[model samples]
Target: MSAAAPSAQPKLRVKNATKAYNTRSGELVAIDRCSLDVKAGEIVSIVGPSGCGKTTLLWSMSGLHKLSSGEVLLDGKPVNGPNPEIGMVFQDANLLPWRNLDANINFPFEIKGTKPDRAWIDDLLGRVGLSGFGGRFPRELSGGMQQRAALVRALSFKPSVLLMDEPFGALDAFTREEMNQLVEEIWMAAPTTIVLITHSIEEAIFLSDRIVVMSPRPGRVAAVHDVPFARPRSLEIMSTREVFDLTNVIKREIVGEQKSRYVRSSDAPVAQSAV
Candidate 1:
C-alpha cells in the first residue's frame, strides 16, 4: 500500500510571549512569559478579567501589535506583518451600513482587486443561515445576522486560521447563543484553527477545545484546560455536571486572579515623586 501523506503541522505556536506598554507614568508589561501551542483544526479561547490583556495577546499574534519580546509563529513562520492566510472577526462586525450583505461579504474580495464571487458569497451566506438575506443592508439585518455576515466575510478567503475578539458580545443573549451555535456548525463544515477571546466562561466552554485562562494585569497563563467535552456540542451540554465542573474551574481561576490582584493593590506603597 502507498504511504499516506503526513498531516499538516499546527497553525500557531506562541513561546515566551511577552508584550508591554509604555506610558507617561512608567512602563508596564501586559503579557509576561506566556506561552501556548495551537494545533491545526483546534479552537482555542483565551479568557480573563478586564485589563488582563487578552485582546493584546490576540493582536500580537495577528501581527497588529508588535511584541516587546518573545515570538508568535504562524505555520512555522514569524508573524511580522499582515498575512493573508489569517482572517479576523471583531466585536462590532464593522460592516458598512451602505453595503448590502452580499456586498459586505464580498468586500474582502473586492479589496484584493478580485471580482466578487456571487455564487461563493451565496454559498457561505447559506451556510450561516442567511441564505436569502444577501441583498439586505446592515441596517436591515439584526445583530446576529450582521455577525453571521461578518464571519462569512472573514472566511471568504478560506483562511487557515481565524482570530476572533468577542464577535458576539454586542448581541442579545438569545442572539448570541444562536450565533455561537452557528459558529460551531460552521466549524464542523470547514475546519480551521481558531483563536477567540471572550469574557463569558459559558461561551468559552461552549466553543473552545482548550480554555487558556489568563492572569490579571501584566497577564500570564494561569491555567490551560482541555475541555472534557465531545464535538458537535450544544447548549444542552452546558447543563451537564461535567460542563459545570469545567466552567467552575475556569471561573475559579479568574476569581483567584482578581482576589490576588486586589491584595497586591492593597499592599502597594504610595506613589512618590522627587523635586
Candidate 2:
C-alpha cells in the first residue's frame, strides 16, 4: 500500500489563550496573552521558569482549567472543558496500586464506558516493552516500567493531542534519557500532536521539532526556535555541539527574561485571551 495520508491539519491550536486565578481579593494571572499552534504529529516543548504559568498554559489547552479570557481550540472548535481528544500525562505516574499494567492502560476506556481495543492495547504494551508486564502490579515493576505503563495509559486512547507536564521529571538522569527516547518512539508509532513542558533544555531540543520559550511570572512567548535535526534522532545527539548550541540559545532567552522581576502582586490579570 502507498504511504498513509498525513494526520488532520492543526490537531491542536491555541490562539490568544489566557488564564488567571480567582482569589479572595482579586484575579491572579497565570498566563498572559499566550498563543500557540501545534500541527498534526508535531512535538512541541515549552520551557520556562517555575512560576511562569507553563503548567497553567498546558492545563488550559487540555480544558482542565478555565481560561481567564482566551480560547483554546481543538480542530477549530473551542475547548471549554476536559476534551476527550486530549490526554494529559502529569509529572507523577500516579498508577493505581490495585491495577496491573493492562488494567491501568485500559482504565481510561473503562471509566468512559467504552470498550477497550484489545489488539491495540496489546500492540501498545509490546511497543512500550511491557508485553509480559501486563499482569504485574505497579509495586512489582521498576520506576521506569511504572512510567512506561503510565505513558501507555495516557496514549491508549489515541488522543489527537498529548499534553505532557514533565512526565519524566522525577526520574534519575539515565532513566530520564531512556524515557525521552521512549517518548520519541511512541510519537513515531502513533503520531499525536504533542506538547511537553520541561526544565531540561537538552531534552527539549532532543525531542521537539520546536521549542517555545516563555518569560517569567506574566508568561508569554519569549522566543521560539525551530530544530532542524533529522529524523530517528539518536541519544548521541545529546552529547554533540549541536545540542549545546541549541541549549545555549534557549538558556540565554530564558535568562534574558529575569531582568524584570519587579512584578506587582496587585496587577489584576493582564488580558490573556489567547492562551
Candidate 3:
C-alpha cells in the first residue's frame, strides 16, 4: 500500500537532510538528502547496515547535530537546536548514580526549574512497573528497569516528539522484548510521535507503524514500508507468515540478497515503496 495522506501537519519533518563530516581522509557524506515525515502519535523505525548514517540522521533530527544542508522542523518550526518539545533517550540509561529513581526521572523537570507534581511522577513510574521503587537508587534496578525509568524520564515533560537511539540495544533478548511491550503500553496510554533507530529488522516490524530502510555509508532512503497489522499486537504475530515475509523484504532491501531457502508464494506480495 502507498503512504497514506497525512491527517495533519507532521509532528516532525526532515526535509532533504544531508550531513557531511570533515575527516582526515576527506570530506565524508554521512547522509545524503534523507527526508521523512512523522505524523503526531505515530511510531516510525529506521533500519540499515552498520556503517549507514542512521544514528547521524537521528542526531540531526534531535538537533544535537546540525545538518550540513536541509532542515528539520518540529510543528512547522525549524529545529535549530534542542527544543523542549523534543525528548531523546540514548542506548544507555545514563541515570545519575548519585540520585534515587525519583530524582533520576525528574532530572528533566529539575533542568527546567519546575517542580513536577508528585502524583504525576508516581503515575509515570507506575506505568513502567516501578511503582514502589521511587525512592530506590539506580543500582537497585535491573537493566530493563533502568531503561524503563529512562523512558519515563524522557516523557515527564509531555514532549510532542520522542527520539530513541537503540534504547534497548544493550538488553538481552527477553529484556528487549519486555522493554518493547512496556514502550507500546506507555505509547497507548500517552500518544506521542516517536522516531526509533534500530538495527534489528524484527524489532522494527514488531514496534513501528512504518519502517524506513536506508542504504549503507552515505545513507539514503532505500524503501519505506507500512506495517500491515493492528495495534495491541502480540508477540505471536511475529511468527506469522505475513510478518516473517515482511521481515525478509526489509532484510533484502538493506542487504540486497535473499538467503531464505523457502520459495515465495504467489499470494505473498512484497509491500514496500522503493525510493
Most accurate candidate by TM-score: 1
Whole-model lDDT per candidate: 0.85, 0.83, 0.85
The estimated TM-scores of all candidates read 0.92, 0.89, 0.89
What is candidate 2's lDDT per residue for 186-265, written digit by digit as tens?
A: 78867888899999998898899989999986789889888888877998888889888888888888876764453322
User: Which of the predicted structures, 1 or 2, would earn the higher TM-score when compared with the native?
Assistant: 1
The per-residue C-alpha lDDT of model 3 at residue 153 equals 88
Number of colliding residue pairs in each model: 0, 8, 0
Candidate 2 wrongly placed segments (more than 4 Å) = 1-9, 262-275
Residue pairs clashing, model 1: none
lDDT of 1 by residue, 123-216 (tens): 8887888898878999998888888889999988888999999899899889888888888888888888899999889999899888999998
